[model samples]
Target: MNELISQAIAQWQLMHSIELVATLLALAYVILALQQSLWCWPAALLSTVLFTHVMWQSALLSDALLQLYYAGMALYGWWRWQQLKQGSAGSRGPVYEWPWQRHCWLIMATAVAGLALGAVMANYTHAEFAYLDAQTTVFSVMATWLVARKLVSNWLYWVVIDAVSIYVYAQKHLYFLTGLFMLYTVIAIAGYFIWRSHYQQQPAVRLSV
Candidate 1:
């Protein structure tokens, strides 16, 4: 076990400086986001920008593109959160649960999108783990949007996405990334329960309003 740890550390040391920075920032983003801190969006933006370069260099085209998407989403999420914090009349209410029917439809949509993108990448590019990449990308896009919308169920989607990402990163010998996603999985679980408690209070908040 020590040897494995040492080797993983050695591998990480050999990785690009930007990758290391991105990993740290990504961790910060997840932690702060879980705490509902406004600072999380900036952390996510920087992390995704660095990761875009990292994934592009690693020849993971889909992931690289996904990082760009994440960067954009970070900005949108920041603005959305700000609006919510300001109590704008047009802004959506507190964290809430999506209906099961909506989640079912989302899952089906994500699968179909992943399959389509995977086929395109497999046929037109040399991208590694095309299907897995697409799966993670599709779900992550939806999950991030859910987070921005303050949906309580977003963390549940992230648990699955992060778990799959661990394998995807491991296959590329990105041990640090694998470790990061593993942490994300655990944090995502914690996020679900945390948000659930907050969600339960929404009814009371509304009643008192």
Candidate 2:
């Protein structure tokens, strides 16, 4: 019993230690991204690198994998944003909104995929809140892509995802992340308005991607 207790305490300390630094970097990523700063990608890359290990240790496989994806997207986002800034893409500005039809299809597809993944994990593995985790992971994947693509509506997607993430992290006793997601939810709302304003100032350019 003493041995188990000691192990648990050590794990808790380690998790919190990592979470603290990851949270700070993640905060930096969000703030910089809000400002359309290219530096956000490097911050996101480092933060997700730490989160991948943390989520894997917590048995959140979907989230762990998502962190890996985020790391890759961070690099891609930086390159793409740099191109946008340089006017290499022939675009007026960095932000654009997807049509309602596209958003509808995206939501339907994401829901189906999330359900399928959740069912597989629930039956074949020991994952906590399998459906919720899978759904959030799927939506986050889409949101992150939209962010990289500089979609104005990405912030709206993140607003919903971050709010849901608060409950998910809380269930795992990751109090720091729970608080971070709470902050994220608020920031995402502000981001939507800020990006929308920027988008409105530009000549509308729609490109199918």
Q: Mind sharing the TM-score for model 1?
A: 0.88
Residue-level error in angstroms, candidate 2, position 175 = 0.5
Local distance difference test, candidate 1:
0.86
Q: Which candidate's TM-score is highest?
A: 2
Which residue pairs show backbone clashes in model 2?
A: none
- On a 0 to 1 TM-score scale, where does candidate 2 land against the true structure? 0.93
lDDT values for all models: 0.86, 0.90
Candidate 2: tens digits of C-alpha lDDT, residues 19-104: 98999999999999999888999999999999998899888988998999999999999988887779745433367788899999
What TM-score goes with each of the models? 0.88, 0.93
lDDT of 1 by residue, 1-209 (tens): 99999998976565557788899999999999888887899999999998998898788889999999999999998998887778834333466576688789989999999999999999999999998898888888889999888888899999999998998898898777888999999999999999888777555333111
